[model samples]
Target: MSRCVLLRCAAAAAVVAATLVAAACGGDDTPTDVVLVTHDSFAVSKAVKQAFERESGLTLRILQGGDANEVLNRSLLTAGDPQGDVVFGIDDSVLSRAVGGDLLEEYRSPELSTVEPDFANPDPHVTPIDHGEVCLNVDRRWFASRHVPPPKTLADLILDRYRNLLVVENPATSSPGLAFLLATVATYGDPGWQTYWRGLRANGVRVVDGWEEAYTQQFSGASGSPGKRPIVVSYASSPAAEVIFASKPLATAPTAAVEEGCYRQVEYAGVLRGAHNEDGARKLIDFMLSERFQADVPGSMFVYPVRAGVPLPEAFAKHAIVPRDPLQLPAAQVDANRDRWVARWTEIVVR
Candidate 1:
């Protein structure tokens, strides 16, 4: 299947109401089922689910809460009285909010020893599962066809030649959008970041509500609905995904990531406070960090595993570009300034 088709199918699945699938018996009142609350983008193989069910003996129920911010907000609203036993896909940009809301119980996974120390945060309440770069993905054919060199850096997007050729999601609504916004903040610093956004706005940068629209609708590399914009704010792993999910085997990906100024987004999963199935939640977290799940991550969700020594799929090994100096902000700093920065971004870029 093509990337477009797969994404459409995933999106369809995300929109459907949450469902319950009962697991094997673990006695009457011991809570044999655990609910996992996550953003719409989460995906894993059936084998992984089966393994978890077979080993932990807990039925996994998933609740997809729109997007990352929406997931965080929903989890926050039900913090102590959580609707789900576990919460996943909370990225560094919003981790502090989850921490501040007191939504998670402090439980360190033993699997942490296997995770790369750089990806590990000091917080015991959350465990890193996967990480990916939010960067500019360019349709190589589009640029080559136009005889225009693809922009290599974030600042290059504002150049006159690249004007009206870029589409980005809204920082207020999307995780990658917020990560890109923070990238600018980290790249340019306070007032300078505001100036950079103004430049982008003046250069006719297109903004959408989410990644789905930006990648599937407005991106020129999309299968059927080809668009004018060649540069999109998307994951560094996206090109590898394109290669892996192509309708036919190809020599190379049609798209590639612009490495400079990319922002790293690390996703973490945690046991929710007051969960009915605390043991099950902790088991789920450990399972996420296990070699089986880590190996499944690249092809399944198109994100690099946090656990070291997990082999990358061939497509990822060849096509994905891990940024040498990806932009980053401390979780506390991001938490402190996220709202103000997003609001300022709206004032400068959206309004």
Candidate 2:
């Protein structure tokens, strides 16, 4: 071929290649992607995330903060143009803030029928996924060896010889810590709860900023610690964690639950009003609420599914305890009174 003809052929080839690449890269306008923002405790296996990708035909991205309150607060402050398409793991403790910020779309999931009505809050903003009782966690062997009796009741923590040895997370930063605080208010009215905290403070309690630090740094034989405080705040299902994460199969968990003032905390999911893919976000929420997901929840997240009829594994069925009357102060009341209550609590303890 002559030089001029060869040069023309190369030029045509370059034009075709550019056209093909344009088509591959979305041609003119491709669908925008979305993100799901949640806390670290939130769990979903690779299979579930893949199913969402395949079914929704859009990429699923996750934006995680250290915990639900952190993610929720950030989302709330940026609601008009959120960083994620959906926000999850918010519970009654943070629902008021979420609602106050108008961060959620008015999404009434059709799957709500699968869950118990009480847990599903009648309002159409958020949907409950899983629930657990927040209770005192005790290392059974530690107490047994020391011959120091573990606290058996809310009152016991203040009066019993176990007083100074307790480790707790700060309510503003820890989910379970906040739930337990709410429980005290429910178990004893506001002023009475204040009185109780004053007593607890006098008894020499140690408070940390979050649950992970309190549990692992201060509590005895936690996941990565060599500490000695026998009592901590965690889910009642923590005993099963010992069996599941244990180095070997054991007869029973090394820990036991102190159930007297257990506070029930239920987690929820909501579609962000700014979602780039609204229907896809709704579908993901539906998938989370499905029976298959609920059944796996106990072992994966250490919580009971709110979806009715989902059977728990033998471990949860055998070990998880139900409080005679789990405490709950309605979300509305909690929101209305939290500032005053927390202030009063701080004055009694920190001052």
Choose the strongest candidate by TM-score.
1
The numbered model that scores best in lDDT is: 1
**TM-score attained by model 2:** 0.88
Deviation in angstroms for 144 in model 1? 1.1
Give, for candidate 2, the lowest lDDT window spanning 10 residues: 23-32
In candidate 2, stretches whose alpha carbon ends up further than 4 angstroms from where it belongs are 1-33, 147-149, 221-224
lDDT of 2 by residue, 101-193 (tens): 889898888888889766765458888888889999898888888887777888888875876778887887778888888988998886788
- Candidate 2, 339: how far from true, in Å? 2.0
Residue 255 error, candidate 1, Å: 0.7
Enumerate clash totals for all models, in the order shown. Answer: 0, 0
Which regions of candidate 1 fall more than 4 Å away from where they truly are?
A: 1-27
Model 1: clashing residue pairs? none
Question: lDDT (0-100) at residue 183 of candidate 1?
Answer: 91
TM-score of 1: 0.91
